[model samples]
Target: MKVLVIGANGQIGKKIVRLLSPTNFVRAMVRKAEQMPKLESLGGYPIIGDLEKDFSYAYDEIDAVIFAAGSGGHTGADKTIAVDQFGAIKAIETAKEYGVKRFVLISSLFAGEPEKGPKSLETYLEAKGRADDALINSGLEYTILRPTTLSDDDPTGKVSDVTAFGKSSVTRSDVAAFVAAVLPEEKTYKRIYTFANGDIPIKDYL
Candidate 1:
């Protein structure tokens, strides 16, 4: 399958690009030209695609999409709304236009209930929630993985539906691995899962 990974320059996105590039055709979309070479070296076809602008071209010949873009914690609510909310919706629309079926979204654990999350991240979660809703209603086969506080630690290759093992955070690489593991599986379609680091191997746990 050919997958278009939006925000392929981000931490989790880069890992996903590397994981998918070897077995599937990866169209890694980043915002700048400088970000191209690393993804290329990772065995992906890197292209420039800005979420804040027109990026419809990135969907061409794409069989599936991985919406991994985010505005980051430092950005204001406006940028968050623009990228996380509106940008994701636009991608869903384009995917529909292109007749693309499969989509995987990297979402936050509190997106389903933003008000219950940390006060400082309520807006971010709200934006993610809106994007999640968009993809769910877009008539595309979709999977949403909402992981708790993301850490930059090495992957455990195992995950749980709840926080356990004294580990409250999910590693970015594990999340990427989960996406790769489930992307081609029919059982995960139209599923919304919330997970964290744990003892079950990803393929078995899911």
Candidate 2:
């Protein structure tokens, strides 16, 4: 399968590229040309493009697209809307235009809530929520994976099958695993599910 991975240089994006490279043709999209070398090293075809701009060219000959890109740690309402919300919508539209088959979105927990935690990042979550909603209604075959508090820990290579409706935490590696696993499976299509690391078995939840 041919997969187009946006934000291929991000924490989880990089891991997804590594995991999918062996069997799938991956087009890694980045904002800068310099980042291409690292993605190419991972057996990905690095394409320079920006989420804040038009990416019609990046959608070429792609079977699936994953919007793993985000505006990192920077806080601002404008940046949040641009990268998180608009960027995702743009990618989805482009994918649809090119007749792409599947879309995998990495979203956040507590995305649609109006009340922000005392220490929670509000703008980012709000933007993610909006984007998630858009994708859900986009009439596309999509899978939305909402994970909480992303960490840099190693992958467990296991998923909690339990349905996580509320807030929780998980690692980037696990998130990438979920993205990778869901792509080739028809059972996950058009579903909106959330995940977290816990003692529960995935089979129990599924």
* Best prediction by lDDT: 1
- Taken over the whole model, the C-alpha lDDT of each candidate is 0.89, 0.82
- lDDT for each residue of candidate 2 in 101-165, tens digit (9 for 90 to 100): 69999987667663643234677778888889888888889999877667788766555533333
- In order of appearance, the predictions have TM-scores of 0.96, 0.90
Q: How many clashes does the backbone of model 1 have?
A: 0
Where does candidate 2 stray beyond 4 Å? 116-119, 161-168, 200-206
Candidate 2, residue 36: lDDT: 90
Clashes of each: 0, 2
